[model samples]
Target chain A: MKRRNLFIFAVLAALGSGPANAACSFSNEVPIKVLSAAFEAWKSVTDAMAECGNVQASLDQDFRLKQSAAFAANPALYQLGGVANNTIPQLLNEKRIRPLNDLVEKYGQHLKPNQLIKVGGDIVAIAMMVNTQEFAYRKDIFDELGLDVPKTYDQVFEAAEKIRQSGKVDYPLGGMTMSGWNMALEWLNVYASLAGDSFLNADGTPNFNNENGIKALELLKRASEYMDPEYLVSDSTFVQQQMQQGKIAMANIWASRAGAADNEAESKVVGKIYTAASPLAAEDARPVAMLFWDGIVIPRNISDEAAEAAFRVAMEGLDTEMVQAHNDDAVWLIEGYKPGRLAEGAVATASAQPSPISYPMTIEMGLIHSAIGNQISGFFTGAKSAEAALRAAEEEYGTAAREAGLLQ
Target chain B: MRFRTFAAFVAPSLLLMVLFIAAPLTSVFVQSFFVTQPQIQRVETERCTAGFLEQQCTTEIKNVPVLDENGAVVTTTRFVGLDNYRAVVRPDRAFAALSAWDWQALMSIDFWKALRFTLTFTLVTLPLVVGLGLAIALAVNNTMRSIRGPVIFVSLLPFIVTPVIGALSIRWLFVGDGILTRAMEAWSGTEIAMFAQGWTIELLMLFYRVWHVAPFAFVIFYAGLQTMNRETLEAAMVDGASRFERLRYVIVPHLMPLIVFVSLIHLMDAYRVFEEVVGFRSQAHVISLQWLTYDLLQPDDAGNRAVSRASASAMLTMIGIVILLVPLLRKSWRDHKGAR
Candidate 1:
């Protein structure tokens, strides 16, 4: 009887491990490492990739700061890297990431055509999801207040004033206007919607010290009057929490975070929040937001065998199975993803007529973005006028461009 | 001690200092005088990204770094004396603002703004730390022997916490409807937003520094008080000197050296004020010199760092520290000579 018990235990152990291996088509042999931003979608993808075994993933919020240096090392630290539109230029310019055409031909048969990020006719990255900022509001509050969803900047201000008069929420509006990158993106979203020209001149000089820049700044200032007085320190997470806790009625927040609005475990206002396309800066312009896509890239400094194994594991991660499980985590580009209520805003924003532009993917855009982030806060802080702030940003960008050898 | 023994004793630390401190200092100094940049060329490139149902492609001129045959970006390094410094300081703009008596314009410049905050934060907090530390030490000394231990431990709690963690805790206590802010609102019968303006944030930062650093000063002064001249105090008391007079003359004079020592250390530490700015998220309103250098050195998304400008800014910070220390150093030097 004891011998039979031991045999049964051994069989049970083997069976218990069998299903895990069954989930992955192939048991990976080569050790593969990945570095990526820490987010819900990344978590889902990395967890899926780990099923193949021998995968170590480091998910960090500051992954952009570490990617270029890590990939530049000989026998690179990570075999796979997660990149977005704004971050891919550094790796591409330095040739730290490998071209994916050969890899896609070999292993990426299931990838959608739209998921291949192409630069100069070379497939360099594989996109998995698209993200954009969109208008999120409390439907119950709007209904009770007898307010309509705002469509343009003027309408937004009007709605905000009405909400303030009603005292329906702690603050009438919220924003992702934290200093540095978040603030800069907020400014750019409005500027892109208002301006009819490019951000830079043909020779790479800043083109934002014009009338559109002033108008964008003035609109931001006007909007701030209805927002929380401490909006300058509020990031996406802060704004999301404010909405979840019913502290604020509305905000233009990231599509990735819209899922949290209905998460019963954390949100006090579950099922009461609804999303819509971002409000326009003008009546005829596109949504006042920029589109961004997060994707995976293999590094150039790694061996071909490692790169192949990494690509296969990544493909497994981006497969339809993962999307079916995590469809609401992002506006997924995979085949099995079904756009739900949370994804409605992202879809609407993307399909708008005269669609919004993607965030620029160039070296000069990076410099100008940093310059604006550094200088635009002065205007909001009441330390500098809008024109002075714009001029300062231009001067700062000019200095950086000269130092970068992009200008004389 | 024998000369060989002394040399052997100091060799390891000397080697470490040279490797970790002096070498980097020399390299940064050299780098401040030079600029290195990648050779950038503009080229038209077609890029495609995912739209809702299809791929959207755009053709635009992009600035890309020229790469060599080895797949490495080609860089040109040249001697550009004082250019990086000029960029950081912007002496022309600063002078223009100064000549016109435009305080706002001068403060608009990053360096001047950081310098103003750093100096004020250091000088203002110096007296508070010294005074509060002395007060706490005296109070603890006067307490009963059994309860004194717990009092001292409780007083040291803020200092025992990590600097960044302590700053963050204080920020949470006062930031936007935090427990303390809510309480203050109830007490004052008005809404309070502690982080809404620059002066209030500065006030909180100053208060946090004092609260976090006073325990260190207290410990030193307490040790000095233990070695106080008991006979001198007794004589002063016997001569009908008042309690305040005895403290003012005897106890204070006894703690003078410790005060100067604490002040010197505090000045150096406070001038490098970075944690408060980060913890308070005060970059929208105020910044410090060290943060400015760090900001310059931080690479943007394109992996471009202002290395030369950061080095120049770092060197200027060190010079400012040295300048701030001259009077204290001279006084200590005189004291050293008098003792010899």
Candidate 2:
């Protein structure tokens, strides 16, 4: 307890004295949620596919498997599978694709042009925070309560009411129950597309104050009536306990976290948790979802040959065909995220009806995110009127963007 | 020979520090001065491994947009200096960024508000931790042997909880329909907004920090009490010293060094309040210089001026800490006077 107050201060001082005003880029938030799940899936496949136990070696083996699969199945994919520094000039100018380009031309010279990599399902976006659908809801609960699977927000509230009255369970709908961060993303969809108010206005001041924002909040707050008594008391993972134990009927959960929702191995409702789009803003509103991203950009220090080898290896994994062949074929995601222009023509083909949503590389995405976390929790907690909460959110979010230097 | 031996022994650590820690730190500091960074050129080359490396050969850093054949932006990285700071302090500029078609912060409100809120949150939480710590110290100073064990262990619970879990837990309790919330509602017959309300957040942070530190204070104070001379207190009592008198003339004086020591320790711990703040998601945040400084030591993820200016901000915080902490240290030193 007798901390040498000044001595400790002096130690910090000495440690920091080496540099003047140097900022450390230590970021903790990697791709989380389904994005993280997708990453894990990718890692698992890569590991299983390893020839030498070394990551690079495994990557090499997997790359060959995927490349061969692509060439044999769809021979036209030639260079399309590798770095497109040609399209995303920044990839080259920023040197994000240089090493790969060099390596493919150099170290990869050993490979025959006619030779194709074998496909074992290596390349794909995995391990992420993608907002998919509910994991542990009973079809019986909806059927017994005479409720249909809600397509839009209008049906959502009706279902909420019916479920609350059914009282067959302590709380009818449960999943990702207590995460404000989770609720935030769901709310963002409404605030942007459903709420009359957009995240940003023509003037760019956060416009969560618009009537649509209040309407969105009010609509979301409607669910509060049926939420578990401890809905706000336990975290999403914790609340998953209630759902997995059959205490609650439904929950809006991440595809990744759902594994834990039912403890896959021991789950009574095994294969029961289903992935669905986030609930709509209103019974009639369009379905909107928050994108979860797990982007992989190689560092700039590796040699050209290695970088190219790594790039090719990575490209082998991104193959949709390879992903679909995985043991868990449904687990291979390719829905939300849109690749940079380099692969637009190719991605356009992949980005059809269902795809894994990732970061949009847009500024408003961050703002909408900020607004959601701030307000959604406010509604469920009943701390503010939905209108007041939305307005407060606008101010805070707008303030954050300003500080981040994105608004102007 | 001595110098040579010492130099030889220290060489590895110094070299490692320079390569891994010092070099990166220096680069970060130097990069802060650059308004624009040099760009690497891309040359078309053959493929090796037939198609392996792509992004590895390149980096993500860019200062200008790279246009495609048709002249559309393939990648756009622009240089906006001091603007990040100006925007952070200037609400109007911050607001403009908010207008981006996206909901993300372009340059404005989020960072400023987060920074402001973080600072305020840290400032308020520090005192509560120290005050409660003092009270806990007093209680444990007199606790029976049997009760002290359980009290200390329970009090230390917050420290044992990881920041992530603690943060999630705080979210749960602060979220809607939490047990604490419902209980308060039943008592007051009115809603108590702990998470959304700015003031309630500070109290939450205080509770977290105080809860975490109370055990440490209890142990130290109890030990200090055990070490106290009963003769002096008995003599004071025999001379008709009242409770307050003995406490003021003896106990308070005796506790001064320990208090300053504990206060300094608690204050430092309190200043580094990233956990409690992030835990509670307190709307009004006031991040400490320490947290800011620590983050600045890393790379800029946001690619904004604030993150870029982080080095300068970190240096500023370090300077400020030196200025503020030096005085408190001197005062503590005075308390330990005549030790030699």
List-wise, what DockQ does each model earn?
0.80, 0.07
Docking class of 1: medium
Per-residue lDDT tens digits for candidate 1, residues A1-408, read 667545533543442322223467887878788999999899888878877766767889899999998998999999999999989989988989888999999999888999999988899999999999889999998999889999898998999888888988989889999988889888899998876337897666798888889888898888888888998999898899999999999888899988999999999999999999999999998898888999999999999999999999999989998899888999999998898887788888888887888887888878888999999999999999999999999999999889998899
Model 1, global lDDT? 0.90
lDDT per residue for candidate 2 within A362-402, as digits (tens), equals 33444455455644564564444566566657655664454
TM-score of each: 0.96, 0.58
DockQ, cand. 2: 0.07
How far does residue B113 in candidate 2 sit from its true spot (Å)?
Answer: 7.7
* C-alpha positional error of residue B93 in candidate 1 after TM-score superposition, expressed in Å: 0.9
Q: Over 4 Å off in model 2, which ranges?
A: A1-40, A51-95, A98-136, A174-184, A191-218, A228-242, A255-268, A271-279, A282-285, A290-408, B1-204, B218-231, B242-244, B279-305, B308-340
Residues B8-111, model 2: lDDT tens digits: 99999999999998898777666454333232223233221111111111122112434455433343335555543442245564567567643333212334
Q: If chain B of candidate 2 is superposed on the true chain B, what is its TM-score?
A: 0.65
